[model samples]
Target: MFTSRGPTLRELAVQALSSVERGYDLLAPKFDLTPFRTPDRILDETAEALRPLGPFRDGLDVCCGTGAGGRVLRALCRERAVGVDFSAGMLHEARRAHPGAVLVRADARALPFRPVFDLAVSFGAFGHFLPRERPGLFAQVHSALLPGGVFAFPVGAPPHFGTLPYWAMLGFDTVMRVRNRVWRPGFVMYYRTFPLVEVLAELRRTGFDVELTPLEGLGRRPDGTPRCAVVVARRRA
Candidate 1:
């Protein structure tokens, strides 16, 4: 579901065929118009959820595409807010949008930062990472944060089996797998790779004390479980 301002089907197909970095470069100019951009509502809700635990100092936004999460950091952190990503094109848009924020070009798997930030947040970018890559990613985040600093992100509950959303995610992952098999410099986005349990375990193993808070504004499922939750992982003090 994209607006008229978003990329065309042909553009999307071209992006899907390109490497992840180049694809995002081509799409960066129109990314906000696409559904792939993190929604404002989610950003607002996350800011609210993080407010109580914060009064934070310096902040970092990992995989900060167009600086949506950097905006969140600006609200919650008292000092500087930095946004990091590998895509120079995405960082270009981010710099224009968040002129006050610092934008850095770096891969998440090997983040180039010290343990200086008091808070770190990411939005809608985890799908790019494979499950096996998560531990290294978490370790990088942990290493980037100050002692007792927080690394937070929201994750949605799994859709009901056999439901349209479920099937849609399954189909999307299948298509991606097929595409990667057939294509070079594959774009690595997948919907089903980041399971909450596995993620929590990885965070713990990476030395974070993990916790979950339901994003009440996002509402609950029929089973009374939250439809979405914010994962707050803190580095040991």
Candidate 2:
């Protein structure tokens, strides 16, 4: 469900056909109108869940598309908030939205910042990174954070096996697989690749002490497990 200002079907088709960077560039202007932008509700809840962990110093937002996560950083961090992404267009929009924030254009796998930030938050961008790239990506985030720095992001539970949501995710990933196989400059996004157990282990391997806290505002599953959770990974001190 996108607003009228969102990308048209033709525009979305063109974006899907282009490389990830170029596609984001094309979509940057209308990105906030689409469902792709991280919702404010999730951002606020993430900030609330992280409130007790603060007060933090400089904050960094990894892959901060249009700077939605900057608000969370500003709320928690005492000093400045910085946002980084690979797309120039997204950075441009972010600058317009958050003029005071430091917006950097850099690949997430190789961040330019030192161990300066005490807190970091990323939202809804993990799907862009393939499973094999997770280690390097986590390492990059680890390197950018100060010792004992926090890296927090929300992850949803996988849908029930026979549910429509499950089938939809499966179909989407299958189509993406086929598309990448046949198309040039394939867009990398998979819904089912980032399992919680594997992700927690990867964070540990990256030298982060990982913790999961349920975002109670989003409600729970039938089994009483959280429908979504915040993975709070602290870089080893």
Candidate 3:
């Protein structure tokens, strides 16, 4: 769902026809008005969960579009916070909104930072990384953090079997597959590609000690399982 000020269907269509970087650039101005922006509820919960991990001196937000997640960093990190995104348009909008923080335009796959940050986080951006590319992405984050620093993000519980949301996700991924098959400069986002199990495995392979914290604000399913969780992957000390 989108706001009245958000991208119109025609604008969204043009964005869908572009590469991921270009599409996000086109969406940057109104990204927070769309459901695609990471919800504030999740951001607040993640900030609370990460609070005890602080006196962090410096923080980085990986793939930080419009810098909503950077607020979490500002709350948790005592010293400095920076938001990094490959989309220059997104970085520009984020800089205007969050002038207190630094912004960088760089691909997450090959971050330009040294082991400088005490913590790093990303939100709603994993789908942009193809499954095969996740390892490299995680490795880059690992390398960017100080030895004991963390790389965290939220992940929702998979929709139940036979549910409408499940079928909707299936359809979305199928459409993405078809679009990439027929088009150049692929938009490359898919809902079902990153499962929690496989993601934990990748984090471990990239030398993280991973853990999950239930995001209680998102509630739970009928089976009493969490409907959403914040996956906190700590780089080994």
lDDT tens readout by residue for model 1, 54-107? 899999999999888876897899989998999988999988887767889999
Report the lDDT tens digits of candidate 3 across residue range 23-94: 989989988899999888899988988888777989999999999998799888888898889999899899
* Residue pairs clashing, model 2: none
The lDDT for every candidate, in the order shown, is 0.92, 0.93, 0.91
Mind giving the per-residue lDDT tens digits that candidate 2 earns over 20-80? 9999999999999998888898899999999999889899999998999998998998888
RMSD of model 1 against the true structure: 0.8
Every model's TM-score: 0.98, 0.98, 0.98
Candidate 3 stretches with Cα past 4 Å from truth are: none
Please tell me which predicted candidate would have the highest lDDT against the true structure. Answer: 2
The list of candidate 2 runs beyond 4 A from truth reads none
